[model samples]
Target: MATKEFKLPDVGEGVAEGELVNWLVSPGDTVTEDQPVAEVETDKALVEVPSPYDGTVKELLAEEGEMVPVGDVIITFEVGEEAPEGGSEEAEAGTEAEAEAESESEAAPAEESAESAESAESAESAAPAPGSGRVFAPPSARRLARELGVDIGAVQGSGQSGRITEADVREHAESGGGEASESAGPKDVEVGTRPSATTKRGEESASAAAGGAEEGGAAPSGVEAAGRDRTLAAPATRRVAEEEGVDVDDVPTDELREGEAFVDEAQVRQYADAVKRAKAAEAEAATEAEPSGAEPSAAESGAESGAAAESGAEPETIPYRGVRRTIGEQMQQSKYTAPHVTHHDTATIDDLVETRTELKERAAERDVKLTYLPFVLKAVVAALKEHRHLNSELREDDDEIVLKSEYNVGIAVATDAGLMVPVVDDVDQKGLLEIAAEVNDLASRARDRSLSREEMQGGTFTVTNFGAVGGEYATPIINYPETAILGLGAIEKRPAVKEVDDGGFMDDDGPSEQVVPAHTLPLSLSIDHRVVDGADAARFTNRVIELLENPQLLLLE
Candidate 1:
């Protein structure tokens, strides 16, 4: 086989290098052309790199979390072909012969293993009994079996093609067939042996209740005693239970796979939810059982306060990595490099709000979701056409300003992972409904981390709605080469002065009009002072305000 190296391609605009976030393929795995092999995160976005050759992965040159430069060999593939070099033809022939001999020698053990697996499968098919033979399971299933200290060969295969599955391994462990030391249950718990001074009586009551149901006797109130086997749960599930102050042993499980108890994170969450509901129901029942306007005794209130005080608080620290680190670095760079000047203003969006309310039902009938963002985007694009500097970039190296003719506006989406800006292309050409649908789809995909590299790039400008999170105004950083960014604050209702018209019928002798409530929107525009003047920023914001106040003007475009 001939070996070939695959280089990392540039994923972002002018991006020289990228961080290798994950590898989808491992060595010895066969890959097809155009198959996603690795996920690379550049300064601009996260993207998947596809395999260019149809071959088996021989080596991964870059490890996960490592930054690899463009044009570097990230992976090696072995194609099914003879060596290209003829420098040592005889030596190559000798090497091939030696490899064949080694393969023949290895084939005997492989054949023996296959035969043993077949015998085990036949025994299992005839009767569900433990067999002494080799196991046939996927790598993941085998790893999980080892972690549980179960004998995979003795477990019955319940998967297609007679292969052992993870469920089978879990079942074997639950059946008490695995090493006793590896199995965990409530009986073996050693934690919380020394009762804390602040430990609540409710826990003891719950444990006593559990003991009575299981052992036919009440457990001690103060300290717990080691009784039965420990609860079988994954490490992660146990951690979650501990964090929530729930005893893992008391968590009941009806999820039986092949008669083996399976307790997963979902089961734990459901149990917690059930407990909360039960407590709420008991409280309500007690409240209804009490006399009208009855107050709790001072002693009862003091005990509740004491219990609350006993619950300790700990600070949590999350490591900065992945998307969070990238966001921080970019923000720092933008703040330091650009001289940002922010202009704050307010726009009365009562007309735009009413128009949206009117068209909402019609949009819904056509399976389209109409949102205020579409109107905002339409208004912003119209304003950008008149004030071109906001949509342009400052080329510091060339000492010039580059105004973009095409309108590609990026909408900032805050996700659990980090902040992701998914660009909406040609906003100037698309109608309001089209822009709304596209924004919704893009934002949805961004939160799910399914947005492609191309979907996030090529933005001429950016618009961030800090208002979504209840913020009134923020000086949003320019999306690095872009000249300016528009921050939308929370749309709120406030008192406004009502004008009495002289030409109207009620103006001459009727009661004077007073201040009334009106819907208002806050706008904060941050511009690169080097590229755009203060007047330009003010003019652009005013135009956006005009379009939003009178949305009918958007139809003129």
Candidate 2:
């Protein structure tokens, strides 16, 4: 039977790795295409990774509860064989062949490497090294060569498929490999410094010589190495190791060839998890061993604990994991990435409250629960139309401001797990009732942990009503990528001066103003200062207030 390996796939945008929550299948079990084989938790949400092949499971490469990077082989499958799949006898034969091939491919024979070294030196002539024309190398290798004052384009590649490895560049530099004329007065390439035009052409010519074929695109057997000790791993493996702050060499592996370990993301993840668990165990032991005051009876201790809890002397500890960790990371990123400026204002929303009261029965007739959120959503969308900058994202990398034509507002919902912002798409196209229904549905699902990842994504802007829980105003962090967030405070009745039309119930005898109760709504607007100024923020707030105060204008929308 031919065996195939399955690698973890990227489940979300920019997700480099995920925690393997559980495995749905076991060894020798048959699984078909599109069948979920594993559940993974990324920074956003829980994702199920489905199988891509129809075959019998041969082995699970990764342990559960480990964080596996994208493109790491998590499992292996055996298929197209009638022989019984159980026991090591059959598995041993299959794995042995696989291991042998892996060893040979990773480390070449010493004699062959020496021969390759000699061939590389001999190939260097007045023109250039034969394989040096198109030296495929990583940016780090190029940077190293430049720092060492070596001509990268003149060095022969000694990596798999003729890709110029970093070791190859260093070796070429030590051997003083370069044109005699250029080597006499070589220039150092500093970091972030641009290379000369002639050097740029040389680098381009070297790449062009291979007809622009992708690096490592050629057959592995076609290339030769020169006794270079390099780690054999995919890019994803290296990326994960870097992200976890672990050296790839430190990761232990049983698949050894020539005393060299072939490291992948799974090995790195296992090492990282072991380190974390060790730290946690050490901390727990320390806490337990610490002596307390004279031990009390069980009843007394319980009463003491209860008193401590009631007096707020002891605080409850909550482990930050899963959704809580996700929220923390996102909040940290947003707070640090954006320079936030907050504008606070309050509007007399007596008109809005009256209009909502008027529409309550009409909305109930259609079996819809209408609230102030729909009016707020519609007003926000209308205001966004007038002030587009608040409804846009700053793409600093592309040096462009993205103004969204469609309104997709995210409503932040507080839940037991954490805060979740579910986006309501095409808000401008939906009526008040439709928007209210969607908001209710999204919030309900969010609280119950039934909201999908997609439902929480693609928000052009965000609206957080902290008023529901009794907050007047807050400086909410910009919800990343998006430039702004609007916070609605609690609505309350306050005394205000009003002009008397008939002068019938005024304290003054004739033509007087009166202090009367009016509904007031407080608003807090926070925006990214890099893309928006104070003036723009004020104008946006004004527009939203205008739309709410003049609820009749919403009919035209």
Candidate 3:
């Protein structure tokens, strides 16, 4: 029986890693294709990972509560010698990926990496160096590389798609960077951690095998130290490099991995610093024959700009991974992409208080725990119908504004893990009680971290009641994609002008106003200014306030 290692597959919704909540199967247990083998809790929700092949479990690679990145191997199984009958397509894909990887590896030995988990060990000894094929390592591995002063590019990946783990870096450094670094040529190729690319300009290859590959017989291997127009880096790293005006393809390092480079933000920053320092130092040396006392030295100025020269205090640390990290990234995206404007207003809700008071008795009889949210949800939907732009998405890609006919509102719920927005679909079609029940259930599940991704998706607009935690008039960020968000403040009794007559009527004949204590609800509406005008926002808020002030009008709909 051949052993098959199962790497954690991408679970969907752009989730890259997950916390292994629990393992359903143990070693020596039987599992089949499509059988639930483990439960992984991603940044979104808890998910059951199913096995892809029929096999008896030989080993469990991960422990409970351990965080595993995507494409990292988490389990091993003993399976039949050949691919199962139903999984030929999967087997073929794996074979094709391996062939492609081998072709790439043969062309460039410094960039040894595996495309799939299978290629990670498939007779890889022939071309195996000391780096990862994917170069898709954890932050810890990259940190280790920096600390050890190792050129991560010169280190070969041995993980899924040639992932370089922390252990890989340590092993490579201890073994003096093994064969890959030795053949990496003149540029500080000995590995471990060599700072400054010019440290080892003319090093020799370890074996005649590498020397023979060159027609010159004994020429340095630095000619092709660069990859064949290919590099591995995370999306965020790429973005950082782009913003910093660094060409990701041109970033240089002293060492080479499987003949390729695994670039990170730190490396990109280092490359930028090195280039600036070199240029500045060259210019200064050419211009000034002696040290000038007026300005600082070029090397000192370069070091000032580089973060490597700074020091900081040690503090209690927490791993900014999983859901919190995901939430932060999304919030950052929304904040940066949209220009937000908030309009705040207050509505006298004395009638709303009386209506809810009366409805409370009826709702109690029906065994429903009624709240103001249902009414607010209904009012917002009604207001959205009049102003379609309020319930829309800005499709920047298509260069169009999509006004959605469906009124699905997402209620932001704060949970212990992170913030969750559970959407209530078709609010226009559902009654107040139906909407209330759905909201209650959604909130209950959201707090418990049981809401599925579907339940949290497809929102045209969002409602956040910050008043529950005691806040008035907040400018909330837009939910993104969605053009607007409605923020509700605390409902309190405040002194307000009340219109009255001799007959004790409100907003009636006499048209006279008097001071009185009235229940008031503050509304804060935040909109994407790019898609909406200030006047449009005011009209929407006025309509919602009007409906809330006269709660009986809800029955007319």
Candidate 4:
């Protein structure tokens, strides 16, 4: 076998590098060709990198959270005689002679190891006993296990091909599946945990620092030790213990399930409470012992308050990287680079609302979610056609403002990880129903972090809906390179001046103006003032409002 170095390939859009988010395979794990070996976070998405060789993972060269450039070796694989693509031929030169020498050496031990090999093979074929073997689970499932503080390896897989799923992790956590035995000296799994680490398929370390227990072999340092070789606790549980100044390895628990102990959130909380109470009591006793009538010295009181405040207010450090970091960099670039101006207006849509109500049933029948967004999108596209500058880019290098001919619209989606803008390509060429369906799919996939590179890029204009989360308006920054963006506010019934015939009693000039409640949609359109003028922004916004008010104009598109 020869060792081969696997380089990071361009995920998409000619990306130069990627942030190594997680390693799907570890050293010594067997993998097949095209199997995902690591997850790389590009500028746009978190993508899984597949293996090019079928072999055993010899080493993982890149660390998680490290930024690796394209064509840089991230991992090594030991494969068959003719090493897989990109394998080192020089490394295989010594293999033939080495194999013969090894063959001569192994012949003597072959007979002696026959029985052991047979037993090992049989054990491999059967279901592995809990608390013992390598876990086969997806990365998402592992992450779930870490959050829930369950021992993934000990939990039985209920997925196809004996793989583990998020549901299995949750079930294992709830059922208190398995834990360390008390007889085992400070087992890796914590007491009270139902089962444990799978990961960023990242998992938590099982073993706690081992030491002498009490004389009676009870847990040491006021905490119940794990029964197994590793302590099992969720990352969240460990964090709580750290904040509370409690050691997770020493957390005491009375609950045991299936002859095992795994630490959980409840156990951590209980331990934290006890530690707090104990400190409070100690403080109170110290106060009482000070004096019967004497007050604490000002210096002493100040010191106590200062220490408590310092500890309580210690800020948690969150490493800003990956998608969130990318978003920050883009936002900063756009804000600092572009001169922005915003125009705010409202569209009264009573007729438009009725039209939507009438067509909603028809839309539902076709399994489409008819949202105000679809109508808004058509309106925006129509407006863009009239005002081409709004749907354009400022090419500073060329010293020109280039107006794009394509009508690709980017919809800003707020994901749990960060902000993502999934673009809808050729919006002018598609129907309203097609746009609606595509928007729904893009939004769903954006949240799931499953959108493709093509789906995330190539937007000429952008739209953001703050109304979904309840906001009136915002000065949205342009999706840099793009000239402008539109923000939508919640639709609310507001008093508006309307022309009504009051039997022409007031005057013969015209119908009298009356104040009436009408459903009004607020809009905020922001543009790059370097290229787009304030008047241009107002004109584009007014065009959108006009289409939205008529809504019939949207159907004509």
TM-score of each: 0.53, 0.51, 0.54, 0.61
lDDT of each: 0.65, 0.64, 0.65, 0.65
Candidate 4 lDDT over 1-557, as tens digits, reads 87787677656455677777656566887765444566676666665565656689999999866889876888888888654343354333332233222222111100001222233223322423335444566544544454444666777888766777656877776777532222211222211111232210111122122222233545334233433433344333445555656555565443332133445555565655444444444455667789678888885676467547745875656557656788999999999999888889988988878887898889889988777788888899999999999989988899998989999999998754678899999989998789888888777656556565567789999998876655777899989989999988877688999888988699788799999999888898989998888988888888998998898877677
Root-mean-square deviation (CA) per prediction: 17.2, 26.8, 20.8, 14.3
Whichever of 2 and 4 has more TM-score, that candidate is 4
Off by over 4 Å in 3: 1-6, 21-38, 50-58, 63-67, 77-314, 500-512
Q: Which stretches of candidate 1 lie over 4 Å from their true place?
A: 1-322, 500-513
The number of clashing residue pairs in model 4 is 34
TM-score of 4: 0.61
Judge candidate 2 against the unseen true structure and give its global Cα lDDT, from 0 to 1.
0.64
The lDDT of model 1 is 0.65
Model 4 ranges off by over 4 Å:
12-16, 78-310, 500-511
List, residue by residue over 45-119, the lDDT tens digit for candidate 2: 554455555578899999866879876888987766543356534444443333222222221111112222223
Report the poorest 10 consecutive residues by lDDT, candidate 3: 105-114
Q: Considering only N, C-alpha and C atoms within 3 Å, which residue pairs clash in candidate 1?
A: 184-230, 184-231, 185-230, 185-231, 186-230, 186-231, 187-228, 187-229
